[model samples]
Target: MPHYKKTKIPLLWLRRHTSDREFMLISSVLVGLTAGMAAVILKTLVHYIHVLLAYGNRLLDQPYWLVVFPIIGILLTVFVVRVAFNGSIGRGTAGVLFSISQKSSMVERHKMYSHVVTSAFTAGFGGSAGLESPIVVTGSAIGSNYGRDYHLNYRDRTLLLAAGAAAGIAAVFNAPIAGVLFAIEVLLTDISISAFIPLIISAVVGALCSKLILQEEILFNIGQREFFAASHLPFYVLLGVLCGMMSVYYTRMALRVEELFEEYQSKVYSRAIVGGILLGLLIMLFPPLFGEGYDSIRLLEGNNAQEMLQNSWLAFFGTNEWLVLCFVGALALVKVFAATITIASGGNGGNFAPSMFVGASTGFFFSRLVNLLSFNNLPVSSFAMVGMAGILSGVMHAPLTAVFLIAEITGGYTLMIPLMIVAATSYAMVKYFEPYSLDTKKLAQKGQLLTHNKDRTILRIMKIQHLIETEFQPVSPEATLGELVEVIAHSRRNLFPVVTADRKLDGIILLENVREIMFKTEKYDLVKVRELMVKPPAIVQYDDSMADVMKKFDESGAWNLPVLRNETYQGFVSKSSIFTKYRKLLIKTTNVA
Candidate 1:
């Protein structure tokens, strides 16, 4: 039974008296707990599926079954998308980001339940995706549902949603700090000390639950890495540039593949069949492109069959043989193509894993090129990991998360400096390069700016005090027009603030009011300021954001407005003075107006 509707009379009384925020917090905890449990359960289920697939491959004496995992994954994805999700296609993290940036909301409350199930299944079935997106979506949706169910206001609802998203990331990644950072970095788009307290609480709860259920294990099993010498700093710098260029390539390729699949998937099963065929053919040469590429990274890093080619740049192309390079490169290109089609053709998935796969391969290839030139004292495997981290950081532009994730997974603090250098270089290289990742681009296309690191707060631009217009004589609401005219004649102000006998604001009366009265012969002497006062004028609290105030100014069409708080009337604000000061400051700072 729902909390409010328990089969007891006292429960209804308790629900009616308690504040809605308390209820949402209680419900959000439940959501986080449940989402954590779901993640654990789904992870176990996916592990079992992997084991079964591995056993089947051993029995059948064919490794192709592993390549076919994505195909099975996509099929199961289609069923969930079609049935459980009720045909709500494109329900992924990018979708959630697009929705939130554009609408200030995540999944609709009505669709929350279906979205969680479908997203969990998509990742669990080997969709070449990560669980972070699902965790974010599930947590955010749960928060939104809690807000709606408990009757919180819009602002509180938005906060709860962000809190839930943070919890989800914390639970799935087992990185509580990173989860909180992701919320502040990507979703909230602003930092506040007060907001952190509740969000931190939620994140701690989520992380603790995950730790209690599943013991701490680094997601990637990276062994001891040989550190690069200081002499190799210049070479790592070059790797940074390569990672940046490769990031742009991945973004372009992913979008192009999405467009191609969207245009070609009209015929039933065409995208699926073509994607399956391409993936099957590609795995023949470079079996590394299959799944999340975690195993591929391990194979390349460990004592594998392929040795680092020190004499050839062709190895940088992802294969040793010139003919094989062309084939493997073409196949790697096609794998990205198929992954894009998998999502565009109604498959529920995320681009995070695929982007990392491309990045890792790019880095691995770059390492070969660096080694080929007789570059000394550089660990090629470490370079590969840097490239992986760089590409993902560049595309996602969540550098801290990318860097920390790579450091944690690799179990190497020595790699942090190089990792940060490469990641920062990639991020800068992409500046105004592609308008902040593919997901942000979608938001832009939908007419939302969603720019990063903006100073849109009131404290950034608000002035201490400006032009209070004391020339404007305060008029009593009961004053006659003749007396107001005498008062106006002595003052140079175009607007006057009218107050009641108790000194509370009545309304603003403009010169246009007198002009309207002058047209009627009898009104000139008979009318009072009370009769002419504009009722229900716009009012603002002093601490409100200037952006919000500006929006209100636009909506209300008030050149001068009253300020109020706690039933007390403060001074008025003139839009002209604010704008004039703003213009001068912009000029002084040499900022674009």
Candidate 2:
């Protein structure tokens, strides 16, 4: 990215003059406004691009434009990312989480606009991905940079980062409550009640922006349909189970496809071309796979599956209800592949929209199939809407967010009971198989994720590599006791590592073990350092996770352990050092009093 000289913030004086609580509340408004505008711009950009492509003479004349548009979109996105951002940018929501966990919530300023530009290009031209994630990233960067510029602490910075995301989510869908829940559920799970105010203010402001500025056609809305019937409770629960299963499929399939693309990350262009082509083929077969698929969601919710099928190229084979059911079922299964391909191929977008799309299709297929085979009359629209929540809950592991977001979008809580049942069931099912959400699974594996488990969170944040102490001094294993005595006199530490000439650790020498021999200086030369030293109870590898190091410490019952890598000496990792860092991080990471 392009570099710019840092400038002073005018709000610094206001922050210094006002109490933190007051300043934060005021800052929330500003963050919400900015983040909401970012959402508006991104959505507007995608909207216009879509309009131009749909109506433009050249694109309209091309019979297979669906195949070519997505490729072109990926090409443009790849070009921008490679040429403008130097071949890399942030990794959407997971990157945001990493910044909070490891980077002290200090998101880069470039991400404020880069994701907006890139995602618009990716989703605008029919790339099968969601724009919500990029929107969240952009909004989060806005809040983070604002906090950093105004000299806020880590706690405040993280809160604002989440607040900004809440605003973006609120602004895009015009669902203020869901926006707040998204931030709380997805970004800051263990936040205090006091922290909710800023998030609430941001989401409200964001919803206002969408209400006044965004056109109805651009919003993700389908006002409530018929009220929920008690008779449909069983079907909703079954849909929940289906959503849970589909969610598992979505997470696993996306993970595998992304892993396959990891090999081509360095070859951006090659991956983009191949991924773009595959995504195009899928979108051609199933037209609903294009962009965010919100239109198809509306179609499904409106009981217009016939219209939805008629728009797809697959309809050429047949339009029987069973065929339609199969086609819709296929959409649910293939959406993950399309979305992952869109992103892995250099397109910038998120899984949020795709999850909703898949959930809608699954819900529609399930309800439709049952209706065709039996006398039971199921509400297809309600099932479609609730399905969005189920998949969202399962895929993102945010049940509350899923329930409220759909409820808000529909402008009523009439389906709240069913939404809860499906969301809870789906979430419970997915949780049984995967402990971490799809966005955080890899980070958790790499020991970089901060979770609700306070112990793990603190440990994960503390890097043992930085805690190793090298000043304990080293002694040559061949050195005599007299040499060791002189070395010990200058060293403050009670323990010393015995090393060979080539800097390999043989064992450790404790001062207490050699105290008797050192006093008898007359025969000091006869006592070699090798004979004085003994094997340490345990050794810590240089790259061991904090959890592993702690386990070693507990088992060894030692205050310090020798750190080694490839049999070579590094340094000692003391329990004191780890405890010290853990205490400090615990303070730094806690967001409430």
Candidate 3:
């Protein structure tokens, strides 16, 4: 055999270092503890923001206060977004998902930092979005960054990311069980022995941190309640169906609002100004639209129908009860739209809590409608909560997370049966209508595959033939960087194949290397492919399965890899091409299925 350098991949490096199970366990616990602390800080900051926003809303009740508060809020938010920190948009859990799905554990550190700070400002200033997003972003980024700093392997890095996410949820809600469920359902998408220990520890530590600080002050303080009566089964089913429809409508409206904001970003404050005016007017007419909707839920739960009705959009319009129902339902749609616009226009906030608020409010309205139609005999509050769970879960596409979260928040296990019934039904219905959730849509945009099975091999979906770079331009290592740039500009390859004088594979020079050389100095004329070629480049045997090829590609973080046998290069594999072919195949397979 010819002399060969012992190339070490990051994945192999990790396995070699982590030889003992106990050491790994201890390391995971430490990771969990660290993640939990970070999550606590993140959650505490968002809560403070929420509190300040509440004060701002109260100020909106006064004319002088109204003008000053909005200005202050907007000014503070701008400082956070523009000067103090940028990249704060998508700062929360959704940001974490976006980062992990597209960039893996190598997220931009500034982006993560900016995300936390700006999200706090946005929420504090009364932006109508959720808080959980920032928490997740902060935790996951910290964990992932720690892994990066320690030079952990890909699998360990992914685990740390998951631990951060789980810890964030636990810290935010003080719900360890819910955190685990959310991690498995939303983040990990699988429960493995390797992942479970760290995630569980992280969640537990996070919950402990929250308990030590917040002392169980949940957003909604729903008192203990009896189980749903058998007589309410029909109503629960109806509520489930209604929630399903609402969930689909809510997701569609939110996405559309985001799209609208993106389309009109050039106008900047004009869209926000207009939205702010509308929100102000809506709040003046119906105070329920004032903030994040938790207070609205509290208002409804207090059963002060007279006060709610007195702000009489209901009575002035006609039948009081029916009119109240209409107003509440309309408000749900408005709030969802507002939340979407708030974040889309660079306001920067969360999504999960606001979604819950919208769902709860919708459920409350639907229950009233059901009661009104049924001689005022339906269990409106119960169905309201049930419907809220369903709609919220359906919209987020995180049924288990919503189910257990609502349960833990309410301190009511009796609601589980109804919650499950509504959650599953609503999720199914929404999925039938609108196939993509917010996270999934972002993944689709980035050309990433979002699959359900852990065992599923990417090769099964991707075709090998499609991944080959077939423009058929072979360059000798003696070729200058100027020539390489010309070739790159003229060709579609992001990577170039470096061949020796005999047209045999010598190494590979990626576009990134060329760009670095061009930017570092005006020495492109002096540089050659051989100078920039990365030695010990990933090589694959032609006989390897597609699965093996995929594993290599992921492990190497290369968009292209070489197929070689006995010093002979056969072809190259491009990740983008593989992905494209996979998408086509997916569409075909789905049609057949």
Which model, 1 or 3, shows the larger TM-score? 3
lDDT of each: 0.62, 0.90, 0.65
Worst 10 residues of 1 by lDDT: 584-593
lDDT tens per residue, model 2, 1-593: 22322234446666778899999999999999999999999999999899899876557345488888898999999899888988888788899988988899999998999999999999999999999999899999999998998878889999999999999999989999999999988888778889999999999998899889989999988889878999889999999999999999999999999999999888888898999889988877787787889999998999887776765766687678888788888889999999999998899999999999999999999999889989588989999999999999999999999999999999999999999999999999999998888898888877777745667867876776799899988999899999999999999999999988888999999999988889997978898898889999998988888889999989989999999988889999999989888888887777544
Candidate 2 global TM-score? 0.95
Per-residue lDDT for 451-562 in model 1, tens only?
Answer: 3433332124454244343455788888888777778778777778887777688887788767656456566568878888886357766666566667777888978777
Which model, 1 or 2, shows the larger TM-score?
A: 2
Question: Which scores higher on lDDT, 1 or 3?
Answer: 3
Q: What is the lDDT of residue 241 in candidate 3?
A: 86
Question: Which sequence of candidate numbers ranks them by TM-score, best first?
Answer: 2, 3, 1
Write model 3 residue lDDT over 216-335, tens digit each, in one string.
444345654546677767667777788888887787777777777677766656655655554445445555544456666655554433355554445566546666676777777777
- Return the TM-score for each candidate structure: 0.68, 0.95, 0.71
lDDT of 1 at 342: 53
